[model samples]
Target: MGKITTHVLDTMAGKPAAGVRVRLFRGAELLNETVTNSDGRCDSPLIENPSAGCYEIVFSIGEFYHIHGTESPFLGEVPIRFSVEVGQHYHVPLLCTPWSYSTYRGS
Candidate 1:
């Protein structure tokens, strides 16, 4: 079985983005919602046994910065859409700042 996991790094702060809200969706249907831990990772996989299909993970960029004292963040929300394959682990990590962000497939 395949699994989906994620973590967030604050580029500006040079640390993990703890307490950030994360939401997972299959198309328009929400599958799960979670918050990042102190290490900027989820406690468990977002999808322990995922099927092959399109999916999305929405990160609360604006809210995270606001709590960290950014009065007006440039990026409000960051939503990443990707395709999953059966029996493959998908590690979609977010490296972000208030102004920009990036993601890629990881081990």
Candidate 2:
């Protein structure tokens, strides 16, 4: 089975990105949506597909911090774009800071 999963860490804060809103989309159309758990993980796998396709996940960083009452300059939004291959498991992880973030293909 082809599936997708993700984990998010706030490098600057040195913890998981809890309560971050995650929006998944296949091109312009959304496929699923989820929020980060306490451990900074989604309750379900990010995606389950058979073959490679364009995908995007948007993270609501600004709102998360604002609601929690933190002085943040994260710009409030981040998006990660990637593709998955058939018969393979893809792990997409986000390492973020208040002002910047980074990501790469994961296992």
Candidate 3:
């Protein structure tokens, strides 16, 4: 079976984005929700039974920056839409700031 994982980095802060809320969704169906640990990594894999389909991950960008003492962050929830294939391990890492964010497939 394939798997999916994620991590967040606070580019502005030059560190991992801890305590950020992350949610995974397959189509309109909610799959899982998790918070980033101190290292900005989810405690567990987001998708343990990954398959070929479109998926979305929502990152609470505004809230994360707000909690870190940044007021009026330009970005809110940042959603990354992607597709997974069978037997693939997808590591979708988010590099984010209050105003911008980016994601890419990892090993």
Candidate 4:
């Protein structure tokens, strides 16, 4: 079975983006919701047995900045949509700042 996992990095701060809210969705249906820990990673995989299909992971970066006192962050939610295959692992990590963000497939 395949699995989905994620983490956040605060590029501006040069550290992990802890306390960020993350949401997982398979198509239009929400699958899981979690928050990043001190290491900027979730406690466990978002989906332990994700089937082959389209999926999305929404990162609440605006809220994270707001809590960290960024007044009005330029970037709001960051949503990453991707495709996965059965029996393959997907590591979708976010490298972000209050103004911009990026993501890619990782091991």
Question: Among these predicted structures, which one has the highest TM-score?
Answer: 1
Please write out the lDDT profile of model 3 over residues 7-85, one tens digit for every residue: 9999998999999999999999999999999999999999897878999999999999998888899999999999888
Judging by lDDT, tell me the better candidate of 1 and 2: 1
lDDT score, candidate 4:
0.96
Q: What is the lDDT of residue 19 in candidate 3?
A: 96
lDDT of 3: 0.93
TM-scores for every predicted model: 0.98, 0.89, 0.97, 0.98
Q: Write the per-residue lDDT of candidate 1 for residues 1-107, one digit (tens) a residue.
A: 78999999999999999999999999889999999999999999999889989999999999999999999999998999999999999999999999999999999
Between which residue pairs do clashes occur in model 1? none
* Runs off by more than 4 Å, candidate 2: none
lDDT of each: 0.97, 0.83, 0.93, 0.96
| Cα shift from native, residue 38, model 2 (Å) | 0.7
TM match of model 3 to true structure:
0.97
lDDT of 2 by residue, 1-107 (tens): 88888888988779998988898888898888899999999999877763678788888887877776768665588888887778788888888877788888787
Cα distance off (Å), candidate 3, residue 71: 1.2
Model 2 scores worst on lDDT over the 10 consecutive residues at 66-75
Q: What local lDDT does model 2 show for residue 83?
A: 74
Order of candidates by lDDT, top first?
1, 4, 3, 2
Give candidate 3's root-mean-square deviation (CA, Å). 0.8
Clashes of each: 0, 1, 0, 0
